[model samples]
Target: MTMEQICIRLVKVDMLSPVRALNRFPSVIRCCASARTDLMRTNSSSSLKSRGSVTAAASSLCLRSRSGLNTCITAFRPPAERVPLIIQPTREFHTSGRLRALPAPLIWMVLKPLQKLIAIILGRSIRKWWLALPPNKKQLFREWTWRRRWHFVGAGAGLLFFVSLFLLTHLDESPVTGRTRLLVFSRENFMELAQVTAEAYMEEFKDSLIAPSDPRHQVVEQAVRILAERNQDIAEISSVPWTVHVVDGPTINAFVLPNGNVFIFTGMLEAVADIHQLVFILGHEMAHALIGHAAEQASLSHVVELLSLILLTAIWAICPRDSLAVLGQWIQGKLVQFLFDRPFSRKLEAEADQVGLQLAAKACADVRAGPVFWQQMEIYDQLRGEPTIPEWLSTHPSHQNRVRQLDRLVPEALELRASCDCPALPKADPRVIFHQAVKLLLDNAKKQENIAQEKKNEKERAGVILPFPQSPPVLTQGSQPQRGGVLATSALPQTLLSK
Candidate 1:
């Protein structure tokens, strides 16, 4: 047959096969065509030509069966043809080569215990070193006053310079909500950027944003409003138009913008067991906004960038070579991002936490929840098996240290809580709250089951074939199915999925 005829016959054979056809043939082809001719004699005279072509094509095709046997004309061909076919020995097919699998559990077993032991020893040594330090270190540092005058002068001068610069910048009212704000750019320009960023962030995480009417969204909004109203910093925030939004993510996080835009994740709602606990978290975020922490952080970051540029300029002036200047610039950039930017951010986080507690207590929320929340957070961090230093060195204070400080601040918090008469501050019993939560969970689960059953019924009523799962769904306590596999349920939210 001609090459085109052979190609057509091959296509027909492939279409008739009960398997997915290959997109393209491999570069090399090997098969036993001679055995196929001997098997075609049983075909009737009228069908001999077509049957012979099919048998020949099958014999020529380089297909392998699971049993290490080659595709025979009779076995591989359609059932209509009763022609017997013979198999021939051929070299094994190898695409790339077999890959060896690593024994992951074995490796983990050897490493995990060693890692824990080392961590324990190192932790003890560090504690000993810290305890051995002189108790008067803080006193000694506080007593040093040589640089106090210089610091005051430098701070005053820097503040005056920035104030003057800010005054020169354009001031305008926000578009979404008219509120006067200081900005280097015009309100229109700022909004354009804000809109672009908001749209991009929303699109990228659209699935994570809870519907406005979701119960969790309502909970977050209520907590935010309570915290905002009770805040001692309300006077500072009164001029700014504030809005709160709930992002529908399962990660425990919350952040506030300089412009009083607050975003809380559903994960945080699940983490916090009660309204008071939620208030503590929201109060902390609001503290960041009320104190102008975001602007302060931006200003510090800008200063760091400016310092890096100045350093690069100095290095270039000294070296006067293109290559040297480029190296200096690269090093300066990395130094700004790693050392100055990150360390400064961590300091701001600690400051916000310290101030946040004061605000929550002033709001008459349960002060005990602050430390308890941090303890729970520590448990999450431990389960994650994350590096301690990275978390400790983050923009926020170490969770353990924050918890310790919160414990120390309890008495002061209680005093503030006593002074407030907000009707929302009454403490609810944990057992009562937990029972209510369980009832809510059961009710939500039943609703979900009903919805699912209704959908199945609708498909059946339409006479449509519904595909049933081959295997039973695995249900584990505290476990949820991720995109790929099941994740341990402890990290899963205890609350039902918000409709």
Candidate 2:
């Protein structure tokens, strides 16, 4: 068959039954190609034009059989090379050579299974962990979750309350202290209370026995006096009326009452061996009063206590009473002691130490003695085998720590002591002073005992005696002479005059 006949037959086969074209075209094409075979095929003008330059392409085409020729013509035009069809959507292509426009639903379809798998894994892990936990632990976890929810709610309420308070109230600064302290109460009221309390204390304890004029007393007194004088030079101290009173006590303690009333126990005198050493101890106590530390501490504590009470009340209201009651009390106590009191005390102690050293220097006392005194205290504690007092308990720093701080202040103290022109007093004999003190104390005790006896006698007489007049009145209310009257009032007076 000729090329024209082959092309016509392939097209006719394709058009007639396209499904069987692949199977029958090879044999038909081979038969058409064979010189001996006489298979006739037909072609149209349109088919000849579409099969571009068939004469040139016919050289390349070899028909082994009529069927192969027909198959090649029908199924193998340009190999239909599967060249990744580029379909442009509405959006532009990305620089990454990927299409910018993705179908939203398709993306969701791809990610949905992955997301579900991740969720299933997390859920299973959590369930396993829950199952592995002890029963009590699981219960605790549940309780903790509930507690956290309540905590957040409480926090929100507290924040709202504070915000409202901030909006409504006025914040006033303290005038006397010059620090910007919160003045919730009027200064007048505070001053009035402090003044009344001070007066009552002084009046009640005016005769509270002081350490007699012993060597220790003189040392302590001199030290205190110098500190007071030095402190007076400070502008803050100038307005305060500083007074020192050395009380007789066995406990090694010292305190500065709010109104600059300093009371140093005799026990502290025994602890301090010399005037220079005594000054450091006294100076520190004085600083507490000078700086109004007590007032500051009281104010801070009051605020903390108030807040704790509010929280405790709220806890009681919301939770099971028995369950949370112990916890609430524990939290409240810890808040009061550690959060409020301990921190305030520690800070004040440190501030007092700093200020006291300055005061001691100004007072022209031996600043070096400060560290020596603390060292001595530490040594004494060790020698006695007594447990060192905690800083929190005594509102004072540890001896070792205080000594180290004092060491830093030595140069300043020495400079001040050198600059001063005042002559030092001669040291007294401790033995003689101790004896005198002992005698004085004994005498005072005896006096007290006598007074008590006199009072007891009077009470006994009152209890035994009848409430009756022993003698008649000489002057009647109506007939009594005026202020210038010379008339004798009683028989005994008239008899004595005649003699």
Candidate 3:
């Protein structure tokens, strides 16, 4: 038979329904066996001479098919040069590729079955208990629920009691500052979270991270070590080992994770003037970690979210329209942020500033540099043409406010420094030097204003206008008295100017 004839026969067989195809499969296999023999006989005289072998092969296939259809089909493998015909249903049904079993999440796999088992047990137990209850008690419960709404009142009271107990149990005091705050998350949990957060940050800044061999990294490590060594009295500082990473980015920021990971940006390094200022900045970041502010903030956020959920449900149920419900939720969120979240954040910032000052002083750093650093930050913001965000709307206190707070804290910080037997502070206060510079700039501005006014009054004004002083007034130890005499600003404790 020709190949075209064989193809037509196979097509006719395949077009039949699966049941008909299976019933006729044996006859189709016989036809394929005959065709294969004919092709082999035509291709080689040697194969045609082996007539007994061909007859035996055909007999063996016939006998195998009676034993099992799948075994018979698999046993007959067509030559690669020949196209196979008459696919057996049992052969196709049984033949399978190796299926790869993907790994499932162990946590979810365990949890799902356990949860369903718990649900089943609880449901059966509850049903049994209900069935065992007295008829009178059941009727009384139904009547109270329908007429008095006792269920709602009981639910509310139960929720309130649970919340009160939870808050009381989680209330923790700061080890360093003695400030009490809610901390539903444990320290270990927060450390794990911090580790994940640190990993994310490291990944995000991977391409921008400075090498450990860099001088900046060395400087930061040395500074952190000095601060940690001097402040060993602080359990939080001495307990955990710190890891430092310097990110080569333009963002003026530094932060410490609860897991003792410190990230510093090059922009912040450029912004700071000297080593003392950097020590204070590091201390400030460390203070946040020492106080476990991350966990406290998370606990507060969880409480806020729970309260908001209740408020949202009430709003959605009470309001007739979906749009009104959405609007109400948005307003509630803003109110919570401004009234609760930001104020709490600012309070924490102020506390960190106070504690950081003490840390810097104990490290024998220039304590007066603390306020001066904030004043420079405020000025830097102004010079960069950045808008000043209202303190009420911001997470951190205004730089000016921080400068004032640090000024008030300076005397106490100095006392701490003296108690620690740190090297005596230089007689020239950075605060005094900063104030004199400002005074000099103001004087120069007034002089230029008078010159411009004089020029404006002339009948024939000179085209050439005098420039303001190019150099700032230098205040040497001897010049300090004279400058104070001119400005009438003493370097006394009370006259310590704030930003």
Q: TM-scores of all models?
A: 0.46, 0.47, 0.63
From the highest lDDT down, the ranking of the candidates is 3, 1, 2
How do the residues 1-499 of candidate 3 rate in per-residue lDDT, one tens digit apiece?
7653563355344433433443556555545455554434343422222222322333222111222333222124345543333333443235679873422222233455464345434444555566777999999878877886787889899999999998899888887778788987777677766776788998999999999987788778777887788888888888889999999887889999988899999878777766778888999999999888877777787677666655655665555555776687679879999988999999989988988888888888888988888887776676555788899999999998999899999998999888887666679999999989878876876777677566655624656555533322232212211111101212212211110
List the global CA lDDT of all models: 0.55, 0.54, 0.69
- Decoy 1 TM-score against native: 0.46
Question: Rank order by TM-score, top first?
Answer: 3, 2, 1
Per residue, candidate 2 scores C-alpha lDDT tens digits across 152-190 of 899989988995585347344433234555434443344
Model 2 root-mean-square deviation: 32.6
lDDT of 1 by residue, 149-235 (tens): 788789889977885676556354322124454443332333334444455666776777777786666666655565666553456
Runs in model 2 lying further than 4 Å from the true structure: 1-191, 199-208, 211-221, 388-394, 412-499
Better of 1 and 2 by TM-score: 2
Q: Is candidate 1 or candidate 3 better by lDDT?
A: 3
lDDT of 1: 0.55
Lowest lDDT sum, 10 consecutive residues, model 2, at: 481-490
